[model samples]
Target: MIYWSANSTNSNQQSLSGSNPKKKVHSGNANNELEWRDLEDYPLNLSQQEVMIEEGKAGSSWGKSEINSGYNSLLSRTLQVKGSKVNCFFDTEAPKILVVDDHAASRMTAAALLAMEGYEVIEADSGAAAVVLVTQKHPDLILLDVMMPGMDGFEVCHLLKQDEHTRLIPVIFITALNDRRSRIRGIEVGADDFLTKPFDRVELAARVKSLVRQKRLNEDLDHAEQVLFSIARAIESRDPNTGDHCERLVTLGQNFGEYLNLSRSQLRDLMWGGYLHDIGKVGIPDAVLLKNEQLTLEDWEMMQQHVLIGEKICQPLRSMRGVIPIIRHHHERWNGSGYPDGLKSNEIPFLAQVFQLIDIYDALTSERPYKRAFSPAEALSVMWEETQAGWRNPELMQRFTDFIHTYNLK
Candidate 1:
């Protein structure tokens, strides 16, 4: 249960729950002696009779459904009291919104509105404060003000969007500036929505709800991708000889792609391919997968089907489109002697070719069940021989050799 004191001046008072609240007030509002109690005191055992009263108004109740909705919101967010200093422990499961405005009245109004809707609202007085809060709080949505002293809304939004960690958090510019140029600027800086000042409460709620829903869906997709990666790692764990193989390939493949000036999309594909290229091996029987002796022709044929199986496994994810080629063609040879498709030189995907070199280089330099680890020079020599025999792209092979030598890569 949450307790609120309306205009009571007792600074040392305890909450109704019998806990002495911490008296650490926010620096901006030193006159307001609001104490924040321990968040663990927040009860999951909510009662129907519980009522949340307005700060200064008495004899008004928001109904049991609203109370229940607020409780549900508390499950995933830190409970913040309106018109007071907020310094509470975070409950990460809640949907949180950050309201940023230099004006105290406007900021409090927005916070109160969002908080009333059963969404956790955090406040920032300025653009700098907003950026700091975003990094620390990781709010699901941001209602940013356009005009500010330093680091305005556009700058803050641009900074947040540029970062990989914070980019997905939706931002809506709430400002008095409703001109076309400002809207275009907001779009360029990655603001998801715009709300003009004296904005309608209904419109604000609708836009916030839509963007938050979209953000959650994107998060779900990210979770699904992580699950696929976990499965790939699990499959790799089954082969003792391939320990850390995927990790090495991902690092090396990314570095080589960067050296080759590959686009961000291609680089992303190379990284995914490193983990998922051999994911089809999950479909192979353990007996064949762990075999120590040379495989019979039929066993070899079955082992070769892993690439196709892996491609099919990952085909459902639209985001994996760029990566699919790398997964399917990494084993193909320049001389058209490869399995599955048997595609000749230039027919193989370029990203796959880049990944194959990293894979082969790692294989040669790392110890295997059958062979000892070779020196970097020795590995490059072996790669050179393969390139000469038409098993690899000669131009790319020469570039790889030069890159290895220049970087002194092991």
Candidate 2:
């Protein structure tokens, strides 16, 4: 017979053995106190026989088949046995499901079903409660019910989707309303899927699994983007004169894209390009990159290779496909006098042209070691001269000029 102890402060330590099995032994902190509970009365049976002992914040699993088979599992996979005052070790891999329904019966039913599948389940009685739980717990998936008393599922989904942090967590509306209008509205509010009342166990499981998988993939992509941005920021840190250049470009490019009524995809590309456009400079030597004077012919050639290198570095990520053109062609001139490809007007990508305008404006306005910062009017005049000299797109230049003046972005 296996015996579990709680709040045992006896300083004696003993190993589990057949001959000298002690009634109680403390392995962790003496101050830790876990509530005494019988494991046999627990609901679910865990497949594994290991008992996890949590000491303070750290935890380790001990006792294989030696643990009593009659002991069932806690909500987590491992049977938690705290020594005086210890918490349980939470299962990080388990997918957390939030079930939102005003009706207690419906919410309990869904929560029970999910718990049976080994998923950690959270319950919310109303739409507002669901939102609060989402922020607090950040569940992997949400099973929502429609026709609630206060904020309905539609409103909840809408609010979640509008926030960038919560938007990606997949929401499945499980309501009695199977009308086409309801489904359309659900889709509009960014519901990943829908299930009519009395959702089939098999179907619900399949949908949840699929959406959760997709969410994981999106998380991986986001992680990759963050790494790339960190590298870009590090590269920028190499230049003392370019303070917050990437951030400035992102803000300006986003504003310009919005002013031009560009598509959302295009705006995203512009934002990414702002950080990644000069990322190729990572390949350039300090002599060329940090030079305060005009570049020598050899230095200029080496500097020009950065764009190509940046494009190559970013090409493997499928999400960067839209920004590749800006990375590669932002340096190209309208009159074909630029470096690398030297494509003339119309040959250059429009996004690249838009970004190039922003880049040039920022460079002119910001002080560099080689040149003093120009006033807004002076910068505009210089850009107009470049446009007149067939080195820039006149129409885009005109619109950008208007955008700057309208926004008073100095």
Candidate 3:
């Protein structure tokens, strides 16, 4: 979300300006009060009052002092993530806060405080409207109103908590109701926190900050769990005759995935995809998977079911739908002759291609009951020959080689 702002000096002693044009200024102070130049006379895109009102939602009082303090804190935090002297500006990567209230004055004030505190703020007038905005915007936090017609705050919170899609989002009730029953009801309906209607700006800011921090921590933990499960079934069930096959494949797949310059989301998928690439092996009869002799034609056919088996095993992870493509297609050949589906070239998912290379490499290099491990050189020679024979994507092969060299793979 890119936001353009007129040049301005903030109360926190931070200024954002270029030699190009007119400037507007905003600042936060020791008491967290915010002061911004009244640009009513200036060609401001939005009113100064508007900015203040938005920032107020985050608990900054929007007074010159509190605004100044909040801005100072925000600047320091931004600089820590980016760097100092890079020209003070708003942090674009910051999470958004949605201020939900039927009252325009309250909504505006809260929003202003949040903005001054360096959070992007969105406003919704009713509970129904808030629900729409929540689904569309996916705000980092929701500051909900307790009283609204048609769909009240409690109902909205209940709806949000019930949906598997939005249930994890933290919601804080912001209302004038100070009754004990109201507070209990809010918690019962899954409110993470609450703020009274007439809130102390400083306290509000602190609570928002704390909630945002916890949200980040939760996201990290979720990622860790996904990664662990993705590979656990593959690693734990296999015998020593395969000799840590899943472990070796995981390392190679991860390295190759990084080489592909995959995003964190993609990396997560691949991590699990690599770890569970052989999950289908679980369904293979022990007679076939552990056979010391060469695989009979019928036995080889049964081995192919592992991909389907793996896909079925991981079906519960529909949230990780992206992973299914890679898992099912990892054995697909570039020439469209491999696996459960004969997808070729770009038709094959990228992660699957990555795993294909690593899988073959691991198979060649690892000792099996039927044969001793091949030398790295011998393995590479075989891979190269297969590439020349149109068994794998030549371009992907080159990428695999670069990945190997960059990661110093054996």
**Model 3, span 259-341: residue lDDT tens:** 67788887777777766777677678889887878899999999998889878767765555777887789888888888888
TM-score of each: 0.73, 0.76, 0.47
Q: What CA root-mean-square deviation does each model show from the true structure?
A: 10.5, 10.7, 18.8
Decreasing lDDT order of the candidates: 2, 1, 3
Question: Residue-wise lDDT of candidate 2 within 1-410, one digit each (tens)?
Answer: 12233333322232222332442333353322122222222332221122223334212222222221332221112112323111122224667788888765556456544554555667777787788778877988999987788899999999999998999899999766547887888999999999876656567667877787788789888888888899899999999899999999999999999999999999999999999999999999998999887889999889999999999989989999999999999999999999689899999999999999999999999998778999988999999999999999999999999999987955
lDDT score of model 3?
A: 0.67
Pull out the clashing pairs in model 1.
Answer: 76-93, 76-94
- Rank the models by TM-score, top first: 2, 1, 3
Residue 350, model 2, lDDT: 95
Candidate 1 local distance difference test against the native? 0.74
